[model samples]
Target chain A: EAGVTQFPSHSVIEKGQTVTLRCDPISGHDNLYWYRRVMGKEIKFLLHFVKESKQDESGMPNNRFLAERTGGTYSTLKVQPAELEDSGVYFCASSQDPREKTSYNEQFFGPGTRLTVL
Target chain B: AQSVSQHNHHVILSEAASLELGCNYSYGGTVNLFWYVQYPGQHLQLLLKYFSGDPLVKGIKGFEAEFIKSKFSFNLRKPSVQWSDTAEYFCAVSWDYGGATNKLIFGTGTLLAVQP
Candidate 1:
């Protein structure tokens, strides 16, 4: 089975521009997640999707950032009026199930999309 | 808030050198730990994970980590490293996020540069 895949390996945009990053998870996976790592910072969770519903979005920075998973197939993270601080590598990950008795399911990650907000 | 910390930012070593990277986490209650490696232009891969039972856990490529409950740490170690081991190592902590789910928090990462 193919691993998770991301689109537009790299993206460049102005501070006020809008950018959308996409992720396609492995077949039959039921859970999807988004994370971002800024320069000199650790990777932080942004949000999670269980099928088409939002499971947890407390990590979302602010109103400018939005994420959605349509039909529980693919996910898109859109940053409207992107800011300089938004420049970082956006990663997407997926797991077969999130209900493991021990919560020890292995998460497979994508190569990530590098966004440069000028 | 829960978080993970990696003591080393960057480490350089020659092939066949012993390796040990420190990882500390601050979180109440039981926590699951993991070490992830990212090679150049590659995605993150799990080196090892510790959920329960035996504190000493072994992973692929001869990597192992020992979970010290008292210190709240899970450090990765390898007796001998190769040039191919050069990568960015990230320490992560996973805890219950309610509803039978877990969320992972990653560290800043330690870059290992192995010289052949």
Candidate 2:
């Protein structure tokens, strides 16, 4: 089973530019989550996807940030008009059946994409 | 609002020395706790988790954490540290919503530097 994989390990964009980060989760995993860690801050959840539908997006910071998972497969997070504060590491994670009665299912994380918005 | 706090922002210790990092959470309801580690140039990895049962939970790499409900704390501990243990450690918490889709709340993180 392959771990979560992200694209463009690093990205640099202007303050007003748009950047999209992609995440390919483990095969058969039903849950996908997006998180970002700003400089000197803790990692914060952005949203979650169960299959192709978003289960929770309350964590999304603002209207400029959007996330989507098509066909219940890979996921993409788009940030438009990126701000200098958006420069940080974006991490993607996935987990197996979350509805199970067992202790919280462990979430496997990917090598985060480091985004630098100048 | 739920939040996690790590007491130490950075720590330096010699190899083979005992290690202990403090973590506290503010959520009053049931919650799950976890400790994650991220090495240089690597992603965050689970070091240990505590959901229920025994408060003292042992995880990979000889790491362990004790969950004290009354104290609202989940502190990571290791009997002996190794140089390879140098990394950033994050403490996280998730509300126990009966296995619902609860998001994780992470702490500011502590950078551990183990000297050889």
Candidate 3:
């Protein structure tokens, strides 16, 4: 089975520009998540999707960032009017159904899209 | 706020040397710990995970981690490491928030360099 895959392995855009990063989760996986690493810092969670509905999005930093999983199989994170601080690597991950909070479920990650905002 | 810390920013070891990387997390209540490795030009991959049961867990590529609840630590270890083991190691912890997602808090990551 193929693991999670991300589009536009690397992206460069000017400040105030818009960029959309896509993530395709593994087949049959119902849980999708987005995370990012800024500079050399640790990876931080952004949001999560279970099927077509968003399970949690509290991690979202601000209103300028938006994430959607239309059909529940793929997800897109769009950043409007990107800032200089938006330069970093965005990673997408997926796992089996996450109905049970405490249940152990392995999450596979993608190669990550490196976004550079100048 | 909860957090994860990886003490070693970088470590250098000769091939066949014993290895141990310290990972500490601060979070009350139940948590699931994980160790992930990212090789050069590669995506992050799961090295091992600890949800419950035996605190000691073994993973692929001869890597292992022991979860010590008292210490609030889950340190990665290997009896012997090879040159192929050089990579960036990250430690993460996810809390059981009784919510839809387990928000994973990750460490700054440690770079391991193994000499041939």
Which residue runs of candidate 1 sit more than 4 Å off their true CA positions?
A: none
Candidate topping DockQ: 3
Residue B65's lDDT within candidate 1 is 98
Minimum summed lDDT over a 10-residue window in model 2 chain A is located at A96-105
Residue pairs whose backbone atoms clash in candidate 3:
none
TM-score of each: 0.97, 0.97, 0.97
lDDT of 3: 0.92
Rank all candidate structures by their DockQ, best first, as comma-separated numbers: 3, 2, 1
lDDT of each: 0.92, 0.92, 0.92
Q: Model 1, A22-118: lDDT tens per residue?
A: 9999989889999999988999999889988888898999999999998999999999989999999999999877677654888899999999999
Which is the winner by TM-score between candidate 2 and candidate 3? 2
Error of 1 at A88 (Å): 0.2
- Name the regions of candidate 3 deviating beyond 4 angstroms: A101-103
DockQ of each: 0.72, 0.76, 0.77
How well does each candidate reproduce the native contacts, as fnat? 0.74, 0.81, 0.81
lDDT tens digits by residue: candidate 1, B82-113 = 99999999999988544645668999999999
TM-score of chain A of each: 0.97, 0.97, 0.95
Candidates 1 and 3 compared: the better one by DockQ is: 3
Question: Poorest 10 consecutive residues of model 3 chain B by lDDT?
Answer: B95-104
Expressed as tens digits, the lDDT of each residue in B4-80 for candidate 3 is 99999999999999999999998568889999999999989999999889999999999999999989999999999
Residues A13-105 of candidate 3: C-alpha lDDT, one tens digit per residue: 999999999999999999999999998899999988998888889889999999999988899999998999999999999988655655688
